[model samples]
Target: MFASVFVIALGLCYCSRASSQSSLGLPRLFGPSEALVKTAIEMNCELLTFPEDEPILLQLFREGNHSRLFAEYTSLEGEVADLPVYVQPYHEGNLECVARAQNNSLIEPTVSNIHYLKVIEPVKGAEIEVRSGSVDLFEGNMLELRCKLKAGNHVSYKWLLNGRLVSQSLLHDDRLLINRTTSQDSGSYRCVASNSFNQTDFFTSNSTEVVITVREPVKGAEIEVRSGSVDLFEGNMLELRCKLKAGNHVSYKWLLNGQLVSQSLLHDDRLLINRTTSQDSGSYRCVASNSFNQTDFFTSNSTEVVITVREPVKGAEIEVRSGSVDLFEGNMLELRCKLKAGNHVSYKWLLNGQLVSQSLLHDDRLLINRTTSQDSGSYRCVASNSFNQTDFFTSNSTEVVITVRDLVSTPNISFTVLKEDFQNYSAVVTCRSTRGTPPVTFSLYNSTEVIASVTVEEQFATFKVPLILGQDLGFLQCQARNGDNATYSEKIPLEVVPVGGPVKMPYTYDSGENYDVIGVTFYCKAEKGTHPRYQWFLNGTLLDDRGSFYYVDHQPPEMAMLMLSVGDSSAGTYHCEVSDSFDNTTAISSRRLYLDKHTLNRLPVWVVAVVFGSFTFLILLVSVCCGLGVVFRRRHYGEKSLLDFEMERMTPVYYGKLDLSHYNEDTDVVNAARWGEVDQASLDSVDEWPQIEEEKKTLEDEPAEEP
Candidate 1:
């Protein structure tokens, strides 16, 4: 019993030892997988397999070379190894831990798994660029700013305006675009570039700030005279200023009598005259303008100001009938010379420094019944006293440039497509009027809505517009207007060509071949675009239009089909080239396999399921039939054996005869007789029965045996 007990204890000890050995897990090196260049990082090697406090050796293997890395022990419990510092290039490699002995010798040099450390470059030296070429722009123009970097990898960018984050709607990958810019958009812009390292920390750098200044178009200019009175005496100083309601970076110029005054006498926005004489008593105006746009300057002219000097004929100003010198053909023209403080004044007109005829002059006015282009010239009015013919004191008003322009004829409209890119399709529409004057206002229209309008000094005007792919061309129109007369050009009849996108050629099994395949149909479609045309290529060879083995069917706009015969050498990599009718953008479909004629026919899923189900049911039915037959046969054989045994051991019984004629064939013999007849007498006379029987037998024995 003691020996048995000892054997049982030994068995328990062996089992416990095996359980502890399986429970201990192997040590692993764990830390971040990535690090930035020139940065130091740490890694830990813990959960050591060996249960000892011996020192560990950390090693790195990189570029077919192995080197020992610096590691130290941690203060925490169960400390294994801690990497002291990780330098780039030298320390970036596969890292592992080796168990060491007390004498600094390797205990086990083999490692289970290795952890890779990848070094990534940091983001640096980011800069911003104004793609629109200038940081200063006018209102209602496009503003595009792009971000650039000197060196970066896997970088993303964000924009800030005046120390606030910009909206995502105006930002693209590295660009920011503001359409129809406003004055509120003027601010200092900055770009921030960032990238991720170690999958947890981020490195970012800021770009230099770019300042933007948005100016408004000059409008509603008025001239203000700073002098005490407009009617200045001779030798009095004159001060005239130009003020703007809305404008920026404005410069002013003084216009005296419809002629430019020298800039030498202008001071900023003010015009100064040290001494004023009767010659300065004419229409005085100021023109306010700014060069804030890349193409043109926005200019505005203030209303005419009549300055009068203390004289007999003062403030001689010319006034046209319509407050404008511009007139249309076959229109009445009138010019009147007026004075601010004068009496008995008679007016005379001069064209191009020449005196006008008396037939066109009337008292203090000049009239023309019908004007023509011949009437265009610089005209001025001279006011004089009628009473003094011998000593005529005359004063000339400012020169007025009268122009009689012909009515604007029907404008001709035409367009040229600038670009056909899918995202930014654009066109330039030109509107021209050969019979009209310069500085004509041209308006471009789509249906009834005006797309854009411009007033150019030349006879033709051009408008840049974004084009939609499927819009009707008849809706594009242009109009030229001068004064109150306007004329529209004929509607455009040309359509915008559709841009083509990526092509996808997907082949599907339509029908199965019985003996020989007719063909296989491949459908090619564009992911997004319009008016795509397709061409088929087999093994890098373009298919002919009248090929005997292939046929092309164009479905128009977006889809096309190619049918290739299966029996020919058409079993190569097949692809389709889709091109846009509007541009040179062409896309090729990915190469796909073409099945041969000898390929096995793929049956439908439902047919295969039906065949499998029928076979399974047939097997089940046969199994049930065989089992029933065996059971029935076994029962029949067992019953036959029992019956034969019973017949082998038979017993016979005798009965007395009674009423045999009344017996029924269907009834048993025992049940057919009545026992109460002569059965008892026959039974009691059994002793004499042998003699009677012997006598009866002797009487019938000879006949019964011999017969």
Candidate 2:
């Protein structure tokens, strides 16, 4: 077993040496490496290793050729490593080479797939062409074009019009078709192609130009005028119109100096005019255009217009004329005025240049009745029209002045007394001139002397005259004057009378009294002179003449028989005034009569004495009885018989034959009878009374007187 082990070891060494030589060293180490190294070798190559003591080598080969040694090398550090081999042809005639090392390491060569390289020629010329060759086309026509590329693969193609790229069919296919071209479709055309290598190419045919043309406009178009120039008066109407070419599809526009006048489309083209005037004149034009490829234009020229108007004329005039030669004061006068023109006329009566009445506009004549100085001013007329106004004045019209004469018409004078008679009294005399201008003066004449005068500013005048005792009575007159026109009212005559003395009384009378000597009538008369008429007043009322004297048949019981009551009205002034036929007056005398109360109360003395004596007797009787009663009573007591006898003896004897001749006849008979009877009784009782008294004394002691 040990011998076998030695042999095994030796064999191993020998194999190792051979493997190393073949793989790592010279060409002969591997058996003639002749092969064509083709890259088409299966699955490429592999690597190998050499033994420890071996060296390394490389071989070159071709497909179907002998392999040749290319290089050799010793293994570093006595070790072997594989190196790669290569083949040239990738697929066909597969060739390969291997490198070996002394250590018996080997490696197969790497191979590559073969790619063929082709050199392409640059593009020589390109062309873009439309189907029709030229680009002149109508609107809505079809257009087709193509771009041809000379050489290249994987090339991109783009079509262009007017320098802008357009869509094409596919990559490198340069054809463009545009259907229904319009005006916007006109332009030049070109194309471009590009490849993956970023290589670019451009081709432009001689510029293909297309233009879209519009159709011409048709005939039968219309023209319109808007707000045409016109000369219109203040109250006139204006109209405008549109003119047309008169065909189908025709429309109109109204323009004012090239601006659209209204928003409404005008179908009818005519306008109307009414109430024409001068202001409706100016230039007017019309425009006509259509949709059929025609140009629009205004009318060749404008038209001009003119107008004229007129105004109204003519009016009226009036004149006034007066008739009458002389105008008398207080006389009615007449004046006439007439409109002269024949046109529409109006009449107005004017005083002092102002319209007087609401007269109508149709009257031709005017009459003024009862004319006065107020109607004497200038008179004229006014004429008017639509165009002018004029006023015409009368030519120097005559003015009439009234004349007033002193005709001595009766004066209407009213007189009033302001105070009672014989007092300071005033008289108001109003004298009026019924037909005079103004400035009337009134004169009041008392007989020959003028008492008062007054001037008046108006035709009527009033005169105030103061009258006192002994003033004269006269006539009064009022005269009026205006320039030369003088007039006088009639004279007024006044009569003055004196107030009378108080009434005297023969208030009582007996039938047997002497009528002539006793004068039973009392005289009472108003103091009178000249024209003064006597009027007796009783109790303030005038007394008419029943007789020459006012007689009282009997006296009043309580009042004096003849007495006069006097007041301030008595003993007034008196004047005698004589007036001629013209009422001129003259005065002759003036007197005033005043009487005292005693003289007026004188009457018969017997009656008075009787009444007075009776009254005295009565007074004395009453006094003596009242005062001497006591004294007489004492005396009679002391000397009663003596006094009685003496009184009895002294008592006068009375006889029944007492004569009536002893009594005054004027004395009342009844009173005389009473006295006579009383005396007679005393005489008859004188003797018997004492005897009877003595006897009675003898019986007195016996209580009754004996008879």
Candidate 3:
């Protein structure tokens, strides 16, 4: 029995050791498997491994009723290793765990890491509420309410009305909205908020009510006048009154021709016109206003008025029948007068400022009975009305003269040509008397002197003389006489032409293209004679001077002609004008020069080509130069080379130079050499000293070059 017991105990110890070595809660190395280790206590532990096998060992102890352990192992290569593990209660009970490694030694459990787990209590009462217990909302108005927690988590909100959940899913937003609403949508509202950790429900609210109204006003008032039209004679008095329909305690105003008229008392609704005249005719209206409002006013149609007065009438004017007269015995003469204006007027005839006939009437007809040379005097008329009187008389002088023809003479008349050798022209000869009664005798004299005689009825007269080419152009004189006296006229000279100078042409062709030759510019010279006149003709139709010329043709290299008759004053050169009526004209001389066709077509072509070719060449040259510049620049510098050169040359160089004199001193030289050698070795001993010396010299030389 002792032998058997020893074997069992040994077996039990072996099983505990094997179990600690193989137990790891690290799950399986491959495939899905649950490799869980059940321990009697909770513990912290991690698996750590290195490139080589090292044995892990641990130590354990207890402080203040808690147990802890630190474990370490050393490999055969002298490398130290550690394994940490911890043991504590798994739930509310005490526990124990052991750690073991692949080297087959038991390890005391050590605490390496700790973790905590927490538990919370469940939620309590949660709810939501509006500001008032029952919310009364207007249909179109915005609804704003807050949901709060009486207990539990900060809650969320929803809304409900009439025990059926109103759709407040969209009320996730803070505000509830209803737009363009009608009267039916007003109701109660509520919200709720909650969370998983709490219990209890919360609520809040108040009631809302609303009403609406509509708008409008009364109708318009009316106004009327009492009297219609007021017409009054000049200097007469007139009055008018106005009235209103729906009359009330109101104010009244008077108006004339639609304009308000002022009076001592405007409150009375009456208009009075005093001392009325033709100027008083107009349409009249009135207006009435009250504290409530004013009535619209309109006037009657206009009225017409007429006025009358009396005026005076006046009589006639008188004058003699002739300019001058000679007083002689038994001469028949008469004086007369006539009326001018006005009605019911009469006249009394007056002679030499005295009344002659009292029976003259307003008809103004008057006459002298008979006349002798002594009856010559001023005559006039006296005009009168029953209401007014006046006198209109001729001037206080006579306008008559007379002569008595007692004896008469047979007058001698003759004509002489002033110039000798009258050729193809006519002349005028005059016959006159120096002293004679009207009706004197005149006679004509030629080579035989006194060849014809005639009775002269006036003091002087003229007769035409026909010239015989050679003999009639000579000095000529006239003889004139009355029955009592005779006299001779001064001599006049006569001239005649040689019958044929160039026959005058009388048309001016204005300068133009159609009249480009000589014939168009020809004009006639005047014939030197009396009553010389001008006439223009184009192909035998008489042309007016004001509008005769026109451009019959505008083609160049053509000759045109016009016809004319010359007057005495038109004796100068005339030019032909040819034009296109664009006010573009070629003078007679210019048209002749330009009619050569060789010049017109070639001139414009040469000018246009020269101008256009110059512009095209200028544009092409500019484009070619710009393209060449871009190409040359790209070929000279590639992208990488351009960037490197910019970095090298464009960076600024500093001029911080060390003083050689200070370095040459003993102490500074020792210190500088030490640091310099160290820096040189660090920079791989590049030749930075030469570059620094060159930059120092450049900076030192810059100031000397400035002057």
- Pick the TM-score winner: 1
For residues 140-168, what per-residue lDDT tens digits would candidate 3 score against the true structure?
44344444443422334455554445565
Question: How good is model 3 by TM-score?
Answer: 0.21
Ordered by lDDT, highest first, the candidates read: 1, 2, 3
Better of 1 and 3 by lDDT: 1
Better of 2 and 3 by TM-score: 3
Q: Each candidate's TM vs. the true structure?
A: 0.32, 0.20, 0.21
Candidate 1 residue 556 C-alpha distance from true site, Å? 98
CA lDDT of each prediction against the hidden true structure: 0.67, 0.39, 0.37
Cα lDDT over the full model 3: 0.37
* Stretches > 4 Å off in candidate 2: 1-410, 414-428, 432-460, 464-468, 471-473, 480-490, 502-707
Overlapping backbone residue pairs in candidate 1 total 0
Residue 40 local lDDT, model 2: 15
What C-alpha lDDT, on a 0 to 100 scale, does residue 369 get in candidate 1? Answer: 83
| Residue-level lDDT tens digits of model 1 in 176-203 | 9998888889999999999887567788
Count the clashes in each prediction.
0, 64, 70
